[model samples]
Target: MKNLARTARWLLTLAWQADRARLLKAIVLLTLGYLATPGIALALGAFTDNLLDGRLGATFVIGVLIALVLVAELMMGHFAHLYYYEVGELAESRINSELIRYVNGTPGVEHLDNAKFADTVTLVREEIQKARAYIEALLQVVLLGGQLILTTVILASLEPWLLLLPLGALPPVIMGRYAQRSIDRSRDAAVEQNRLARHLLHVATSSSSAKEARILGAEAALKRRHERSWREATAKLWRGQLAGAALRALGQVTFAAAVCATVYLVLLQAVRGLVTVGDVVLVITLAVQVNAQVAAALSVLSTLHAAGHTLRRLDSLKTWPTREPRTPAAVRPVPARLRHGIRLEAVSFSYPGSDRPVLREVDLDLPAGRTVALVGENGAGKSTLVKLLCGLYEPTAGRILVDGVDLREMPPEEWRSAISTLFQDFARLEFTLRENVGVGDLARMGNDDVLTDVLGRAGAEPIVRRVPGGLDGALGHGYTDGAELSGGQWQTLGLARSALRDQPLMLVLDEPAAALDAAAEHATFEQYAGSAGEVGSNGGVTLFVSHRFSTVRMADRIVVLEGGRVAEIGDHAELLASRGLYADLFELQARSYS
Candidate 1:
């Protein structure tokens, strides 16, 4: 109960914060709604009395009152809907923006990859819609409660003895609570099942899994799994509907009993000469109006119950931890080149949930204007080491120092601005060719001169020039007029993107030229030599990770790893003379291509 109270309070606070103006308007409309209910009941009661007496003047007045009540009701309903829409849209936008921002900024990358997190994201998306409905429904509940109370007061004043009959219908509201709980339970189950269904659909449609699924003839099996999830979700929904139907029937029975009790009280008053035929007509009219009010209030409760899961999900999003906004650091002019070497001392790291470490006790000294190579077999932690150095990941043990300042202590956003990195599996962003490369440094993204120069340095100028829009040409298979680049061409684009960085202090490439042919690789390395190292004597350090021995041979120094430990570190000739791991691997690669 306490937990529920806390959750309800949180949801109310979120709604309250959404739109103050709309909330205030909605409250005023609800109060008007309450006042209108009594007028409507009184008008009906007066019409019944005048009809019994056959009074034409009273009938004319009743007719005018009815028209006024109808007009006011229509206007209130219109403004209430308008107010709800304005408030609902505001709440939905606020919640969704916060959800997306928090998901993007959350610390652990693992959380972003999990099944539960994916389901939560999907539920949050659905919750935005539900949240909109919830606010409107909640406001309706308030209006319904107010109207119900007003109608009851009007009926009680007309005949005190008749009020208990309608009060006896209170047990039906208890039934409405049971209905709500049942619906809420099913809704939560449906959300979970829908998540599973989506995951199954992804597995069946994924490009990488398609070929295997066909070879194994597993399409039918996957379809069956999807259907099973759907069935489970639907079954829960059907059960809830059955329970709601049963409870609604019970409410109808209670309503019938209230009508019988009201008639008996009216007869008793008539027998004692306490009420005239005209007064009896008025009493019956009020009783019927009260019944309808009770029914409307109960129905609102039912609707709220059905939407409880959505409210809970929306509340969860509103409660998600927000990233604290800190004042920006005082901007100091950074030098064009690194003043000192970048050092990694006894650094070790492993990805979340993995028992085996990717890099252990790895130490490196990369001085400014030098070219360094990381050589190892696949999974030798080459890529992980680059990510750590580039400030994407912090080392589990030890520290990275830049000009003797610990990298961990620096703002990660500020640290990242000083380096450019292209991973082995860099994203093929679906955007214009210029936008794709220009995104490396968003501040300089629209500078056409810089974009052209960077593309020229990466040997991608010819590719861009051939496109219809040149720099503006869209790239990807996802849209009309989208041009697909070959693997080697994409690598060049990645290189161009790195080149766009504003005075990058270090350039880190993980298997950068893996797709280029031997001759293309040679030419690419030659171009890299002039553009990568010091133009005169002071430039950013360039670090390369590759499986290709030919590519590693171009580096000034190659560091070889064997089982997460450095096996050898020396220049190409020195390692070859020593006949160590680097020498053996290079000879084997050379023999394969001979």
Candidate 2:
């Protein structure tokens, strides 16, 4: 009962916030409509009794009153619907906006790794889509309560024994609560499978994967998997629906039996001459209204229960702690320039929901203003290390120090603002070319001179010349006149975006040139290496990861990682002379090109 009250308050608050004037108007209309039910019955009974006695004047007045009540009973609810419908739509939009802000404004990305969080988000999204139905159910429940009260009073006035008719509604209310619980459980259990089915459907129909599916001849296989998942989800829901229907039928049967007994008692009273004909008519009509009210109550309660469940999930999501909350007073400011390099001491990390550490305890330093290259096999934690440097995740053990200060002491947003990065898997935003590249530094996005300079530095001038509107042209295939560039061209644009951050304290490029040709890759690396002095002047560090030995040799120092541990660190000439793991790998790669 407490939970019900809380949910009712929450729903009312949402409606009030959406549109106060409309909500008031709707309430007024709905009240008049629902209360008119009992009024109509009373007027009809009075009119019947008057006509039977042949009182022409009283009969005419009573007949007119009955007609007026009937019109209000039929017309008011429909008019109320127009106002509430708009209220529901506006409430839904507000909730959706809140959801978007919560998901995007979180400080860390760790919560995104949990599958349960994803499922809850999916459910909340689905529930908010039914906002219209929820609002309607809420209003009906309110009006119906008043109607039921008026009905009980009329029944009791005719005969005190008829008051027992309203009690019959209890069984159905109980059954409805139990039925809703079963349905909720079924939906929870089927959420994962339903999500999988949706993913499969998207894959089957998406244009991006069309060519690959045709080439691999996997269309039939995808179809079969989608059908299987959809069937499983559908079967679970159907079972729940069947169980709920059966329970509701049983409850309604009990109520129906009670209604017949009440009517019979009223008829017996009339035969006994204990009550007038008008009393008999009023009792019979009120009994029928009680039965209808109980059924409507069950439906309204079901919708409210479902909406309450959704609200609880949303509340949980809002309170989830994604990262340790820090106060501004506790956070240190980022240094304007790096006087010393970054140091990693005994640092290690493991991803969420995993026991195995991706990066084992290791020590390293990147001196201010020098270029450093990282080389390793696929699972050597190169990308993880880069993410750490960018403050995406905190280390599970030990700490990272920047210029003699603990990295954790500085604000994450401030620290990240001082860094620039270009990863192999980068976003291809389907917007204007300028917008795509300008997102790197929003403050300077509209400065054409800055954009042109960055594009030239990244060797993307040829792409700019090819596109119809240069920086202003739309990009990607989403637009009618959009230009879709080759993979290498897109990578060049990503580089240009990264370059927009001028003199960042840390510049990280993780396989940034993988899509470019051998000559282009070499030229790009040479240009960056030549500009190392300018980057180093402000004590900035330029760290890059590459597979090509030719580009790796250009860095001032190289670090070799193996099995999640640092194996070697030296300049190219020194490593070749030491003839360690680095030399063997370089020699092997050189032979491949020979």
Candidate 3:
């Protein structure tokens, strides 16, 4: 009951915040409409009695009163609906904005690694889509409560025995709450499977995945998997629905039996000359209204129960811990330029809910004003190291010191603002060419000269000339006149975006040229290496990851990672002379080109 009251308060506050005047007007109008049900019953009974007694004038007046009450009952609710509909729409928009802010505004991406958090967020999103229905259900619950109260009083005035009719409503209300819980549980259990099924459907239909599916002849397998997942999800929901239906049926039967007994008792009273024909008519009318009210209440309760669960889930999400607990420390600003550069003092990391560490305790340093390359096999923790340097995740153990200060002491946003990165799987933002590249430095996005310069630096100038409107042209299939690019072209744009940030303190390029051919990749690296002086001018360190030995050879220093630990660190020639793991890999790669 306390939880119910809290949810009710939250819903009412949401409606009030949406539009207080409309909410009040809707309440007044709906109240009058619902209360007219009892008024109509009384007026009809009085009209019947007056006509039977041969009082023509009184009967005519009573008949007119009945018509007015009936008209009000029919029209007021319809008018009230107009006001609340707009209110629901406004409230829904507000909640959606809030949900987006809550998820995206967090500093850490740890929650993205939690499967339970993902499932809950998915359910919350689905629930908020029905925000308008939730508003309607709340209003109905309020109006129905008042109607039921007045109905109980009128039925009791007819006879003490009829009081039991309202009491019979209790079973259905309780049963409905349990039934809704069953349905909610089913939905919770099926969320993962449903998500998988939807993903499979997307893969089967999407243009990007369709080509690969055809090439691999995996279309039939994907179809079978999608069908199986969807079937399993629906089967769980079906079982819950069946159980809920049975429970509701049982409750309705109980109420129906009560209604019949109440009507029969009223008829017996009439036969004993204890009541007039008008009293019998009023009793019968009120009994039917009571039954309808109970049914409506049950439906409203189910809606409220489901909405309450959604609210709870949203609240939990809002409070989910996204960052580790840190002791009180003075916040520090990010440095304008690297002096001693970044030092990883025995740093280690593991993803959330995992026991195996992705990066074991290892010490390393990136000197200021130098270009360093990271060479590793798959699962060698190069990407994880880049994420740590970018302040996307905290180390599970040890500290990363920038100059002499701990990285954790600096504001995450400020620290990240001093860094620029381009990853292997970069976002393909469906916007104009200028907007796509300019988003990397939003403050300078409107500067055409700056956009052109970064595109030149990234060797993407040809792409701009090829498009329809140069920088202003749309760049994806999402638009009517958009120009689509190949994979390599998109990667070039991503590189341009990364280059837009001028002289970042740390420049990270994690497999930035993965989509390009060997010759193109080498050429791109040569261009970037030629421009590395600009980054070096600000004491910035250039860190890049690549499997290509020719590109790796350009770096002043190369660090080879094996099994999440640094295996070699030296210049290209020094490592080659050492004849270690780096030399072996370089020789093997060199032979591949021979």
TM-score of 2: 0.89
Give the per-residue lDDT of model 2 (tens digit) for 1-594.
676777788888998999989989999999999988898789878877887898989999988888888887778888899999989999899889877876766656666777888898999999999887888899999889999998988888777887788888888888888899889888998999999999988888887786688789999999999999999999999888888888888889989989999989988989999987987788778877888888898998999999899788878788876777777777888888888889999999888888899899979999887889999888999988998888887888989999988888898889989999998687777788899899999999999999999999899989889877989988888765688788898889999998898788898889989999778888887777644357346678888898888888989989998878898999999999999888999999999999
Candidate 3 or 1, higher lDDT: 3
Candidate 2 backbone collisions, by pair? none
Per-model TM values vs. the true structure:
0.77, 0.89, 0.93
- Candidate 2: which stretches are off by over 4 Å? 47-75, 275-281, 327-329, 459-474, 477-490, 526-537, 584-594
Decide which is better by TM-score, 2 or 3.
3
Our tally of clashes for model 2 stands at 0
TM-score of structure candidate 1: 0.77
Off by over 4 Å in 3: 50-75, 325-328, 466-470, 479-481, 530-536
Residue 266, candidate 2: how far off, in angstroms? Answer: 2.4
Tell me how far the alpha carbon of residue 153 in candidate 1 is from the true structure, in angstroms, after superposition.
Answer: 2.0
lDDT of 1 by residue, 296-343 (tens): 767766656544555565455445543333335622333456767788
* lDDT of candidate 3 over 308-330, digit per residue (tens): 99889888888888775545576
Output the TM-score of candidate 3: 0.93
